[model samples]
Target: MELQQMRYVVAVAETNSFTRAAERCMVVQSALSHQIARLERELGARLFERTSRRVRLTPAGAAFLPAARQCLDAAERAAAEVAAAVGEVRGRLNVGLIPTVAAVDIPSALRDFRRAYPNVRIGLRVGASEELVEQVREGAVEVAFLGLPTTSRPHGVAAHELAHDRLVAVVAPGHPLAGETAVDLHRLSFEVFVDLPAGTAGRVQSDLAFSAAGLSRDVAFEVTNADFLARLVGQGLGIAMLPAAYVRQLSGVTTIEVTDAPARVEYVIWSRAGRTPAATAFLALLDVPAT
Candidate 1:
């Protein structure tokens, strides 16, 4: 039988008075009586015993009362939940980041986003640019702050160029280059390099920057991510060219500008396809300056 029929049965059973049940159902008593009559006819069973002073349920009505109440309650609850899920801004969002190993401004932006959208649950995952990109393309996560222009921007994936920063050299505090105002390509050609992994966005940018200076780096160590590269640099594994955000904000490393270099980097990505309102709101924080 229809859910509406079950609701009528349940409402009549609860109130045990046709007049009260009609009021509860927000319909006229005549309409309620007509529907009940149709229900009983369809079920081929008598449901109510009508009397001058009161209305009471028959044995069959009592037997069906529990099932009818459960069906009506479930229908009402499902409607409420579905509306809240889609119409309300309170939900969970998963965002991925590869903004260097230790980021300053990006973290600050997240603080602002959290305070603004308190109901929107937030989670962060750190991975290489390659992994972040893959996670987004596979719909494993809702949003990611991966490095600019992934290897490919599939049709549905749209990205924005949020901030423009540069790669700087990170050297040990006691290294000879530590005292220099800036490191030049001519000076770095022979210096040992701690590089980002071969298939990551940072690596692509680093290779291009070095190539533009007409210098082939003396590659020493290649790691999966920038955080690993930074720690290695702290141990004097080698100097590295890292995004300014990570290098300048992180301890145990010193950043020096590269002399006479005309290179720039952009943090240019957000999950465009299938973005929920919560994810979209979080991404808006990226628009404000990285303070």
Candidate 2:
């Protein structure tokens, strides 16, 4: 089958409307129909089943859809690879970042990337680590900076460890633990904790740590933002377990080292599937070895 025909099939399958697919392909409805019909005849099966209200893919079409999309993606990647070979980086590069990424200087990295590849388009998004990982896996975001567990790795993605920051306990200056150089995990079980909402990287690690210590603290406040959690800790609202990189610089909090704490490891991850030239160029700027 012709490449254009595969493109037409994928467009129709995605839009599920012949007229809309025609518009997307920039071809008349009749030509699109004729080519699809010819493709069906050659393949000896109908790709789509028609209805008055909607168009649906047949079983055979369902089986063929993913392969068709993969072919299209492979073709585009091949073309992009050739362009990249000639030192051209000019396309949209969607990058994802976790809400708490203080250890890495992302702004400086982006500024340098723009200086090197001015033509490349950049899109930045901040999200929870789990959310960002999902976006990267689905190709919605081309690359992501995430806080992954030291022992755990996300499946179906390539990850490079960029930096690691220790998880430390932060308390108000007048709090009982403020004067301590280091505190054990179990020692904080009676204290009220200010923590990230459930499903965040910080929250996940904190939960694991508490569970490992066979202890659970009172989560008096749950905030989605790390800065807000730090603020709460600083105001004497509650003690919090947070990254040392973030809590160390906060004005109103005293950071106490957490013995046996899990390291908040920063990872740069991307889909294992082929990436666009723009994404590759942007990744090179970070100096991370491809995994």
Candidate 3:
């Protein structure tokens, strides 16, 4: 019924404890419970199953939760839209990006964004390119920065190409291949490697290159973080191939040019349906034209 009541319900459902929910919502336990009870009477369905130890959402509560969240999001968007019309941006900006993002410096960009729109709250999520893309399409993330193989493009979203570059080999200082100025995929494939997990966009670039060259490399370690992968390579665990720009920022590893390396394209993606004002402002900051 009331937005405040819905907020309390969502808070309780998420925390799974009336006491914690009350603390989170900054309301007394009795007050929150009373409001929820009043809401239940109005809706004619109990929204939660409370026990001595824990609280769980009832079937009806589960069904109502999603709609309640949507309502809250819509209301926030409406208020943000009005603010935007008056030349002020105020909204939550949820951004997702791959861990190896290089086209834009995320921390610096966020610093500038915060200074420009202090009222807008910013949230960041780091993930693989595929996961970030899906989050953008699903509206879980308002914008995402992705890096995919040159042969691949993000599907089901509006995207702007940022940059493309070939991957370079990264090896420990004492590794045999570390002294090489440049190497072909076939030559590199002979060595054990540390790489991102199989099927991830980051790993696929090297995999595709090796497969095309009719060579295969053993991935002795698979890690989600690029820094960790580089550390593994630095420790002589294995070698890795990563974006040229990204590799430059790492220490304790030697970077070699790859003559026949796979290239990756960086893209900034957003929902095709529409853009939130905060998202539009952030994209504008990056010089992305309106689409």
Candidate 4:
């Protein structure tokens, strides 16, 4: 029988009258009678003894009472547990990050998030910015960090601007252009530029900036990873552009300002499928409090 049927059985047994039980259960007496009749039919036994003036339980009804009560108690407790899990600060919190962010920016933020959400299971996936954005939109990830130019943040998605990351030119110390305070766009024409492969967000940002400057910058090498770019610069392969704050923090790479380039902003993204407490709490951790 159904849980509600067991509940109806218990109510009738305790009150010893179907009319009283149905009223207490907020159902019509006839409906309650039908439910009990169906339940008894299924059980192949009598659950109550009816009389002209009153009603009482049969031996079978008395025998079934404890099971019905325990079932109701167990169901209530299970429902409460599920609610508690949802409302409390504990669950798997899936997050996405671009590889550049995972290496250059998120190390400290990740450590702090883990400490803040010790009970939360944090899963981190690193990929290109384009992949990260798609993952957030599809609900494969709860939050992400990406460099913006996202004219549209896709349908049902929300964004939070984190920081304006300055772009710097990374070069090996021995490169001819390394000692300058900053280089104008023309100096770049003399250098071998490491390109972020076509179709990536980083590549788009780089192209848009150069195009705005009325210069067609050439790509000497195309690579996906900025951390690797830093290493290439350190090893004297080419002079390239990268996020100043991130690349400067690494040793053996000289970061020089690139004149008049737009600042890169990191955005934290989430979509319409509401965030869990674990995800919300982690978002707070990633948020840099405003001045």
Instruction: Give TM per candidate.
Output: 0.61, 0.71, 0.96, 0.65
Order by TM-score, highest first: 3, 2, 4, 1
Total clashing pairs for each candidate: 0, 0, 0, 0
The number of the candidate with the highest TM-score is 3
TM-score of 3: 0.96
List pairs with backbone clashes in candidate 2.
none
lDDT of 4 by residue, 209-260 (tens): 7777788776878887777867777888787777666674678977788887
Local distance difference test, candidate 2? 0.84
Query: What are the lDDT scores of the predictions, listed in order?
Result: 0.70, 0.84, 0.93, 0.73
| Per-residue lDDT of candidate 1, residues 1-291 (tens digit) | 788778777777788888898999899999888888898998899889999888889999888787776676456545544645777555666777774634335678778888887777777888766677677775556676655422233234555555556667888888788888887777877889998777576777767666777778877899876677788898898998876665665789778898754333344344554455666666666652221
RMSD of 1: 16.2
State in Å the error of residue 236, model 4.
1.8
Off by over 4 Å in 1: 1-87, 99-104, 149-156, 260-264, 285-291
Error of 3 at 249 (Å): 1.1
Any residue pairs clashing in model 1, and if so which? none
TM-score of candidate 4 to 2 decimals: 0.65
> Where is model 1 poorest over a 10-residue stretch in terms of lDDT?
148-157
| Per-residue accuracy of model 2 over 1-291 as CA lDDT, tens digit each | 987889989999989999999999999999999999999999999999999999999999999888887787667667667778887776667889876787578889889999988877789998888888888887778999888777666667888887788888889999999999999888888899998888667788888888887887899899987788888888899998888886655788898898878787888888898668878777877777655
Worst 10 residues of 4 by lDDT: 148-157
Best candidate according to lDDT: 3
